[model samples]
Target: MGTTVETGPFGHLAEDLADLQLPTTDAEEWRYSRVADIDPTRFARAPVEPALESISTARATIDDLLGASTQPPSATVVVVDGSVSAAEAADPVRIDVHAVQTVQTEQASPNAFALLNERLCSAQVTVTVDAQARVVAPIVVASVVTTDGVVVAPRMRIELGANSEATLVEVHRSTGPSDSLVVPVTEVEVGRDATLRHVLIQDVSVRSDVVGSVTARVEASGTYDTWIAAIGGRYARTRVDCQLLGRGADARLVSLYAGGGDQMRDLRTFQDHLARDTTSELVFKGAVDGRAHAVYTGLIRIHPDARGANAEQSNRIMTLSDDAWAESVPNLEIENNDVRCAHASTVGPVDADQRFYLETRGVPTEVAERLIVAGFFDEVLDRCPVPGIAEAIRPTLAELMSGDRT
Candidate 1:
């Protein structure tokens, strides 16, 4: 990458890496996070190599997790240990087949993972979806770890055609009993009057740290719905930024996170109103236990031209254990006079009165806690427009709430 282009794509990334200053837990934004503990030199780069040897092996694992059958692609973008293959094209779809790879790139921020990604990421890819065409089945973007001390950086860019639509499912896993880092950045552009629905299910693991972010731009009259459910990862943070660039654009951001066993998950969402009559809403629910912690920050910004815009955001968190922790912050910046905006946040333990009521109703303590937690998330899960996702999430939710199943 040229100096100008590199600086243009990632402005602060270059400067931060050059300074090599570790981010502290003191910064308000970084208070709950610290990356210096992870020795940077201990993580070796894993390169993207040929997939001929692991093609069958990779497909088997995918089938086992997804519980479905599929045909093997003619080709793939393979990253073996922290490097990119000379024979592989950065763009996977152009190969006329399914591509698999691991990569990393510099992000435009000083956030712990983003800064780490700047210096450690070796290979990256950008996936593009053409206009007007539709992809029926779920397109799986798999990132599998090979070595224990290996770190991988993978980037995916998805573009939807003027009226095209598709479903993408991203799976991140490690091949061995090593501490792996996977940083995935996804950029999506929804066309005018188009509809895009994205479902992000994170099962990376409590031992892994997954920093995934996506920036989406919606055209006039377009609709975008995002569903994010996180149940694993030692420290997983997802940032979803959506810009309503055209009039009547709409976006719905919903997230459900369960942090257990000392794990922490942080989420930040931004909704930008650039056009008139645009609308957006954000709803997040979290459950924490076993000394786990969860952080949520949301923002809604309306520009002057975004008159008649309507926005509403709310976050509610439930603490399942005495040691668990939760924090929620929602901010709204309005520049237009003819707009409606509101935000609300709450963080606390399950009500004793409600718990006692459930216990008196012949429900065991464990079952009562599960019921309360289920009800807490059910309000948002019920809104999941996709039919099977809600039912599919019930068992996972039960596992976290009951602490019995994995």
Candidate 2:
């Protein structure tokens, strides 16, 4: 193997990760994951700064990537191939490029991809909403990957000050059918009495793979709400860890995913209640078709000090074809008797009764199945934090059901 000559702010991380090995399915955290299939060394890292012509091209295509929307964003930050190409912000909000910072978390072990992202990312983008500020429009961050045979690491940090309220939209897309790797890491800090609504959309090429991580901390009386839509990629996986660190903190997570044609969608989540009166709720739904596979594993842990904590988790999946496969696992570890926690998971095909009802109502078999699938995801899509996300995804969902995804 050739040595990697590292350079940049995290250049020294190469030494620390020299002996570290990539995760395998043998580990519980990596079970059902395709980590063994990936060879990180085969892909080169993106340049520290993208070319001016590349930036112009990205600018021209940004609108098409984000889709048409009626409302203009309050702030916009565009990252092309892991480098910041354009950024603009409104009042009381700040956008920083190439900000060097390390995330501190106590709940999860060191993730190999996350560490690699920090070391190899061309730039780190930071968005901050000041205290007591209220932003009616959403702040949009678009991470675009356009090169093939390369690895792109995108890092994002969101900080909400006390008593502030804001909505953030993050979208990941690949401009071409590139066989590449994308490793992204996001860190969120919700301050006391703050409310932050976050939405993430992942729509990359089917020839590519993605490994992403999100870590968040909520302070006293703070609320953190997030929605995730995983619709594209050959093998797409995401892990989320949320810690309620102060009294009365609340966290809500919702996710929707669809897999087709040998694709795989894997999601893992951890809800940790460490303080008194903390609360959390999670709902994830997905469908697999045409020999595709889906996996959902989640855990809710209530610490001894987390008195009066309440937590709920639910994951449901539908298999559209006999060749498709899915797995759902939900667990709870409570150390406090005063806490209330419940978890439920189900893996099965579309409800026969619902399909029959639709068919008996004169709906065609294909149309009935499509309607059922759309209605199944409507529960989660209706709650999307972003305005146009649901509308944008409806057409894609229709195409997936019709096997027209290209």
Candidate 3:
């Protein structure tokens, strides 16, 4: 498995990553984020296993965070330090769970950090659903990293068969010192006429560093919808690449992010269209307060043959403090003329008119600000594929927003 001549899917990936340097802020994709916190060469390749006592405590913490009782998942896969602790699939939902040595990936990431993960990860969890099967309850996958001064890379692959439908709830959390790095890559393949709903919750602690990516390929008449609710981590960055590769495919991405108290939140997105009659839309709304920073860069590219493609990208951020900063860029490269496209970005303080109107109604200044911030995130929260995700985010958002929601 260590050599470049192995005949496997992930074979030669390490060789391809050999001699690659870590990306600095000078690179276009890494322009505004701090990557040093999670650099692979700066930390030990092997992570110290989390203690059983600590793991028991962490599992209890996760159960409370996800409200496992109310939103009881049909299947649950628990991953700790790059290994799966448990994979549970209930009755009536036909699904296959397995383990693999190395995963061959067709989507290559531009960042060396991701390749470093592929080179270092030890295990992965693979989930597959049969054709035409509908799994009503969601599948919950939790990833946790517990030791400091080390690297943990977790791999996940999801395969949905033709005309199948399901939902996945992914939670990433960490409890470590400042130098801990958790790099997790997830690959999803959606089959023809299938529907997949994905909800990603990044709820790490304030001292963890995370560089994560989700790559998905959608087939004809398939629908892939995703929503992200990020609230924790000291320096965090996530990327999403959606490839609409078949006719009548649709993809939608909606996210809500917040960074406070010197924390930094960065996100990158790409929507590449390769087939006709494909549609894609992305809406990201966030806030930065207490001298924090947030950065967003997105690209929408329509191939020459995708003449009937339609795509839109919108990113809006509210800077609640004078010390807060935000940067956003939306780009598009179209080789075809018969397509619909729109891109919008904004970073500013609360709207004067809205704030003033609330204050005119006798609302206090702090309360008015909270109300406005809550309203701004509501537009996308209303569209979350899993209602429980929005409910789960309220407490964190409220705490970060200064008692905004119940």
Candidate 3 Cα outliers beyond 4 Å, as residue runs = 1-20, 45-49, 90-107, 175-179, 402-406
lDDT of 1 by residue, 1-406 (tens): 1111111121223343455565566666666553434444445555435255454454454455555324332223433333333212222233122233323323234455555554554544444555665655444556555545555565555556676665555555554445766666666678887667776766664577777777778998887878788776678778888989999999988889887776788888889898999999889899998788898888899999999999989888898888898888888899999999988899999888999999998999877888888889988888754445566667867776555533
Q: Could you tell which candidate, 2 or 3, scores higher by lDDT?
A: 2
Per-residue alpha-carbon lDDT of model 3 for 1-406, expressed as tens digits? 0111111132223354458678888877787989854545556654424468657655765676677336578888766665555667754343333343444556555666677666666666666777898988788888776656556677778888999999988888764433567788888889999988988888777677778888889999999898888777777888999999999899999999998887889999999898999999999999988878999999999999898999999999999998999999889999999999999999999999899999999999888998899999999778877655676677788776552211
Off by over 4 Å in 1: 1-22, 36-39, 50-61, 68-123, 175-177, 383-392, 402-406
- What is the lDDT of every predicted structure here? 0.66, 0.85, 0.78
Model 2 scores worst on lDDT over the 10 consecutive residues at 1-10
Assess every candidate by TM-score.
0.80, 0.94, 0.89
Number of colliding residue pairs in each model: 17, 0, 1
Best by TM-score: 2
**Candidate 2 global CA lDDT score:** 0.85
> Residue-wise lDDT of candidate 2 within 262-332, one digit each (tens)?
88999999999999999999999999999889999999999999999999999999999999999998988
Predictions: Cα RMSD each: 6.1, 4.3, 4.9
